[model samples]
Target: MCRWLAYSGTPVLLENILYRPRHSLIDQSLHAKMGVETTNGDGFGVGWYGTSGTAKDTPAVVREIGPAWSNRNLREIAGHVRSHLFFAHIRASTGSAVQQTNCHPFRHGRWMWMHNGAVADFQRVRRDLVLAVDPDLFLHVEGSTDSEVMFYLALTYGLADDPPGAVARMAGLVERVGHEHGIEYPLQMTVAVTDGLRLWSFRYSSQGASRSLFYSTRVETLRSLHPDLDFLREASDDTRLIVSEPLGDLPGVWNEVPESTYGVVQPEGDAMFSFAPALPA
Candidate 1:
């Protein structure tokens, strides 16, 4: 349904992640090899934590209702803005309107979220799912995409306090509603979320077969393996990326997120944990 990447570590120019990689998110927008679709050109967005200046606690976001590859504004911003953490997404609409608001990397305060999957038969269950969101949060749900709805659902379930648990409850709710509507495998997702300091990614589906999701190998490990690579040397030990597909074909540079698992990435290191939907009553 889309392609996305989340980066965390030493502050780097946004272009380094969005355009400078051998197979950057910009490249993926036009030539994605691993996503369900070969192109994700409907729209795109970038959300990043500013390292200096005012409002450092919240991220700054830019979204456009055009293809990332052709967006001059996107290129200019990527070349100038620097961030310690950021989320980027390019969308290929799955039955959703392709307006600017529908672009991903949705923002709320300091938190940013994006997804690369869809709710199976979303139209059939959209009403039920929308009603499930907390009324307080519902007004903030601006887009008509299942992905945005899912983000709000996670927030409604307590994302600000416990992200993993909140996401689990959100998934459980989607499956519950989907099943009630006679959908066998109601959810599909490969999600990335960040709250300025920490990044969390998840991969799971109702059928136990989710979409592709991967995380970069530790920078230190890659450094040792390829000491001659200047990029590796320039990057700090904590530099990491969670993406829908490997940015490049570099072997050992990326690891597949196991099915039904979530990962946490911080400056200390990375950790993976088993994930399952815990339906809320």
Candidate 2:
């Protein structure tokens, strides 16, 4: 339904990930290899943390209702802006209106969230899911897409306090409502979220199968594998990327996140853990 990528680590110009790689996010917007749809051209968005500003902890978001590859504004910004953590998404509307507000990498204060799949039969369960969002947060939701709704649901379930747990609760709630509507296996998603300092990504669905997700190999490992690559030698040890598909064909540079798993990336390193829905009472 969509494609997205999140970067955390050394501050680098956005163009490095959005446009420079062999199969960059811009390329994925037009030729996604792993997503259910090959092209995600309905809209695009980017959110990045500003290093020094009145809103340093918060992120600046730019969204447009156009293909990322052809958007001159996106190209110009990607070349100029730099951030240690950022989120990028290209959308293919499942059933929602195509508008800038509906673009992803949605922002809420200091958090940025994006998704690469859809809530199955979303319209059938939209009201219940939307009503579940806390009234305070619900007022901030500006889009009609299920992706934005899911983000607010996570925030309502405590994303600001515990990301993974909040997401599990959100997922559990969605599945509960979907089942009530007689739909089985009604969720599909690979989500990425960040709060300027740390990044969290998840891959899960009501069915055992889920969409593709991958993280870059350690910078050290890549340096050893491709000693001649200037970028590898220059990148920091903590540099990490979570993407819907591999950014390049480098044989040892990407590892698929296991089914039903989530990963946390910080300056310390990357950590993988099992993920499951924990419905809140």
Candidate 3:
């Protein structure tokens, strides 16, 4: 289990989301309120797309296996770097080795992926799922966590062509394989994926009890509600965030993503839609 946040909007200093908020991601790294564990200090990582033309050319990432709050370099970099699309994750390893390679916000070329839940009976189904990954993509897997395997699986199934469909298929594959091994609740996840332009997040589980996920209300709307808040004034109208939990106690500023649903955030628009496990072919 882990805690993560995805930001898509006007480029702003990373600190605004990582530290400025009353209950920021760094705070969650040590005081997560809704995660299975209170402190997700196993490791942390951040991925962002720079000002370069496309994601491949401007990709920048910083990760370490130390507590995020104690990392001076992380604090310095976060305060200066800026990006319109970014992801930050604080981890709490679930059977995975605590190493830099095992941190979340895993990247592959122009895409980035992170998850906040575990696959039920991962060991039992790991073989089946790993074998399903394309060998070319399989070679890139440098870690042993189910999360990394899940990302490659999505790529194998065409994540670049259709993210939502690819993820739906990936989830279906995991469910199918897990069931064959007699595991009842095959998946539990609050996942975030980005391609430098658009962001997609999902909250779902095979058993219907998904972990918490939320998205912030539009900055414009919030400005009207809390006209005196200085932070709201500085943020862009489209500034939005999707997190494992609300970052602060701003009443009505955060909305729970419905059970079995996924959300898409883009510079043009945003929407939340129903999601269900895809049936195996």
Candidate 4:
């Protein structure tokens, strides 16, 4: 439905991830190889935890209602901004308006979120799901897209304290509500989120076939695998990227995020585990 990526690593110009790769996020906006849509041009957004002296708790986000590939402001911003953690997303609206508020990398306090799939028959479940969001948090829901609703639901369910758990609960609620509305496959998503520190990503769907997702292999291992790649040599051992698809054909550099699984990236290392929807306790 859409394509997005999360970067948690040493600080570098945003363009290094958004524009430099053979199939950079910018490239994917126009020529995505794995997304449901070949082109994701409805809108785009980037949210980054800026270096010290800038915003440290919540990320500073820049979003536009135009196609990312042709946005001069986005191009300039990518070149000038750098961060240790960031998210970039290109939208292909399932049904939402193509407006800035509908762009991804949605921010709320210290957390930021983006997704690459839809809550099936969203309009049917919209009322139920929206009514479930905590009123205080619901006030911050600025867009009509299911993606934004999902974000707020996660927050309402406990994202600030338990990301993976909260997301599972959010998915549980979506499926629960969708089933009531007669939707069989209530959800399909490859999602990424961060709190300006650790990053959490998930791949899951009610029907068992979720959107595709991948995370880069260990940085040190990649360096040993391809000594000629200058980028790997300069990257920190902890650097990692989770994307909707393999950024390129680098054989040993990317690992598919197993279906129905979630992973976390932090300063210590990365961890992966099974993911399943459960009603919030």
| Residue 37 lDDT in candidate 4 | 93
Go through the candidates in order and give each one's C-alpha lDDT: 0.90, 0.90, 0.89, 0.90
Per-structure clash totals for the candidates: 0, 0, 0, 0
Output the worst ten-in-a-row residue range by lDDT, candidate 3: 51-60
Give candidate 4 regions above 4 Å deviation.
Answer: 53-56
lDDT score at residue 217, model 1, on the 0-100 scale: 91
Look at candidate 1 and tell me the lDDT of residue 152: 94
Candidate 3 regions exceeding 4 Å error are 52-58
TM value for model 3:
0.96
Per-candidate TM-score against the hidden true structure: 0.97, 0.97, 0.96, 0.97
**What digit string (tens of lDDT, one per residue) describes model 2 on residues 46-154?**
9999765333589989999989989999999999999888899999899899998999889999888999888989999999999998999889999899999999999
After superposing all C-alphas onto the true structure, candidate 2 shows an RMSD in angstroms of: 1.5
For model 4, what is the alpha-carbon lDDT of residue 172?
A: 93
Off by over 4 Å in 2: 52-56
